[model samples]
Target: MFIRNERSIKEFIRYYPVVSTIIIIHILTWLLDIIPIGLFNQLYHLGVGSHWGLQNGEYWRFITPIFLHGGLTHMLFNSFSLVLFGPALEEMLGKAKFLFAYIGAGVLANIATFIIHPSILYSHVGASGAIFGLFGVYVFMVAFRKNLIDSQSSQIVMVIFIIGIIMTFLRPNINIYAHILGFVVGFLIAPLVLNGARPYYPPQYRKSYDDDGEIRFDPNRWKKKRFSRKTKQNFLWTIIIILVVIGVLYNVF
Candidate 1:
């Protein structure tokens, strides 16, 4: 199990430069902090959270916070999660969609944080929000396409999600809302990003169990609906509906 995933991660990163660049940028930011260079340090501070980052016309901060970290430990933990889950997701969704989902989730997480806690005047930094976004994609994909993974893998994935959510509450000074909102955005937008990217069951696995729970493998009994381009278009329509509803609510007096 681990071996296959490891091989896939390597292949995914080798073929895709976006994930590698993100990881490198995060590491470089950490290194920059330790080196204490004047100009590099000055640019590094751009990622540190600011309440008016969006309002002050420094819109980059919306996405930059996902690369910044509070400390070495913070960076390490986030880096671990990123490499563990980010690559496969990028492979599944394709680079452009994956990048959009990540940045979009982080931006919404930050936006939600501000709306929910307007008085909390502290600089936020960390990739946990974006990491949780990847986690969210994993969860949604698992829910939609259970045949893609085994039962054991699904159990581990659920346990990780449960433990991760619990940790957000147990740890102080952590923005639980950001993680939650990131997850929500990831869950909602993943279907649209997937957009016909789901893996289909093979011909041989189309078998059914007997009344006493006996196993059989038949190659001809095909019953599942085809996940075609029309299905992808329906998901895109759902995304549009959701966005239109949210926009109306936000702007309506």
Candidate 2:
């Protein structure tokens, strides 16, 4: 007899909020490409490869490159992976912390790329470096929580890393160095990002049972919970909208 042990759809959804958000952004970016507006393409041109490395200027390129993309396929693949990995990481680290980690890793990856290929005028785009960083973080988390060599997660990550290295050597356009650097940085930062997170517990079990058999988890019963699904959704949407607006503005002006 076959036994299905899949998680509930709701549970799957909860584990992938960040991933869904990234996918939405990717779809939006793709849509912008087909629209009559020339804004997204223009914004992309300005954003990528705008950093200064050993050069005398263009210092902002280090951070701006992460927002850029070379084409629809590039953005789609990168964003898909982001969605796959980002939510899991974010849920573990909290949305705010995850955002910081993503942006920080992306910026650092761009910097590393710029340092390595400073004089290349060609624009570098896509979220590969940042996504790779998240991969690193995932691997690190799994390794920390389980056996490094024997764990299925760690083994899978190792295979991915090996494949990435091989692809880097095989492909002329791939940014292998950036991927490597981002992975290292993400792995290094995972522990810090995940510090002090309460161990996984069911929602119902999260509440405390006092000696009197009453719920005693609340420090101030009068005060509302600090964070919830609604709060997280609102915060996520706000950031997405702001980023979209910025992209639009960049295209128009």
Best by TM-score: 1
lDDT of 1 by residue, 69-104 (tens): 866767766776666566556665778998988888
TM-score of each: 0.72, 0.64
Q: Rate the local accuracy (lDDT) of all candidates.
A: 0.68, 0.59
Question: Model 1 clash tally?
Answer: 0
lDDT of 1 at 6: 30
lDDT of 1 at 184: 92
Q: What pairs collide in candidate 1?
A: none
All models, RMSD in angstroms: 13.9, 11.9
Q: Compared to the true structure, candidate 1 yields what TM-score?
A: 0.72
For every model shown, the clashing-pair count is 0, 4
lDDT of 2 by residue, 1-253 (tens): 0011125746545655655665666666556555676886665455556543326576676766665565665665566456434554665577777877777777788777777766655456667677778777767766685521234335445655565555556656767767888887788887877775433222322345645633334455325435665765565445444434433443343
